[model samples]
Target: MDLFIRYILIGIGNGAVYAALALALVLIYRTTGLLNLAQGEMALFSAYLSWWFTTHGVPIGLAIAFSILLSMIGGAVIERVLIRPVTAPGKSHLNVLIVMLGMFLAINAISQLLFSTDAEPMPKPWPSVSSPGDPVGRSARLLDIGNTSISWAVGALALTLIGLCLFLYLLLQKTKLGLALRAVASNPASARMVGINTSAMLMVGWALAAGIGALAGSMVAADRGSVSPGLMTVVLVYAFAAAALGGFDSPVGAVVGGMIVAIAESLTIGYVDALSTIELVVPFALILLVLLVRPTGLFGRRVVERV
Candidate 1:
């Protein structure tokens, strides 16, 4: 039972990371009706920025903040300069997709060229606590439960996820900007007729998505203790699976789906010896099952359009 609880906690930790990425995916999908294949690469670039800052003696928290800000600006610029031109109403979706794919490859190459292909260790923002005798500090563990322990890093991440979720909920449900964004997303023509700046809202959506991706990437890199050009590839796959499983249009669905995926992956690897080598298959299988049973996703609404 203790072991099970430990695995569950660990799964939740991993799920938090997936949820962050899935949220970004859902944000982009909601606003543009398209997926940014380069989202993960954008995140990878932000992670590298954070690492670079830390290596230059900047505090980890400050470094992450700076990275997020830069990522948001970069996202806006990309949307304005690259994505916006190709994503006009009459433009082909394939063009935007191709651009995103090209960005994926370009960003990966840029990271390799600038930061090198070598993996670099990232310092944990929160300190770990190892034992009862350990002093409470940045390195101290949060708590010890039964035979298992939760480190400060995991605890901080969990808290951060909770905070982010609440902030998003409020933003989407209560803010004027959120309402405008939703209006634009629902019907750009009508939104523009009503005086909403659809283009600016689209830019905001991209910027917000990129900022969230930066956070997710930083957390993942910190957890793994290293960052590299391809750091986000596997994570990107899991995030896609989570977003699909939860209903690409639902933020709550994304979080729930991410948790489900992580828990399933954890249990499969921990108990199913034969599947240990292929644990990544678990998320994809879940995605297939969800699609077959409910194409709109577990929490996604079924859209009805008149012919």
Candidate 2:
């Protein structure tokens, strides 16, 4: 039972990171109607930027903040300069998809060129020790139940996820920008006709997604204790699976899906020795099962069209 609890806690900690990235995916899908295959790469680039900043004597928290800001601007610029042109009305979605694919590859190459292929450590934002004489100094324990211990790092991640969700909820629910974003997402032509700048909303969506991705990348890198060009690769896969399982269009679904995926992966690794060697396949298997069972996803609404 203690072992089970420990694994569960570990899964939740990992799932929180997945949830952050999944939220970014949901944000982009909601506004742009496209799955950005480069989202993880964009995050990787931002993580590199954060590492660079830290290496240059900047504080870790400030470095992460700066990176997120830069990522937001970069995301908006990419949308305006590259995506917007190709995404004009009646244009082929394939073109945009190809562009994103190209971006994924290009960004990976650029990161390697700019930051080198070597991995670098990322400083943690939270203090390592809760108090003096604590045995687990790097990650202070938040709770101890039986033999299971929950760390401050995990708590921090969970709080960050909750805070992000609340902020997004309020932004989408209460703000004028939120209404405009929803309008554009629902019907771009109608939104434009109503004087909404659909293009700007799309850009904002991309910017927000990128910013969120930066935060996710930083947190994940901190947890892993290193940053590299391939930092977000496996994470991206898991996040995609989570987003798909929860409903790509549903923010709530993303969080729930991330937790579910993490828990499932943890359980499989802990209890099923045969599958441990191929643990990476766990997320893809879940994606396949979800697709087969519910094509629209757990929280996704089925589209209804009139001929």
Find the candidate with the highest lDDT and give its number: 2
Relative to the true structure, how large is the alpha-carbon lDDT of every model? Answer: 0.88, 0.89
**Cand. 2 Cα-lDDT:** 0.89
Put down candidate 2 lDDT per residue, 203-305, tens digits, no spaces.
Answer: 9999999999999999888877789878899889889989999999999999999998988889889999999978868877888898899998889878787
TM-score of each: 0.94, 0.94
The digit string of per-residue lDDT tens for model 1 on 262-283 reads 9898899889999998999888
Which portions of model 2 miss their true places by more than 4 Å?
129-137
Residue 36, model 2, lDDT = 91
Off by over 4 Å in 1: 129-139
Error of 1 at 184 (Å): 1.5
Cα lDDT over the full model 1 = 0.88
TM-score, candidate number 1: 0.94
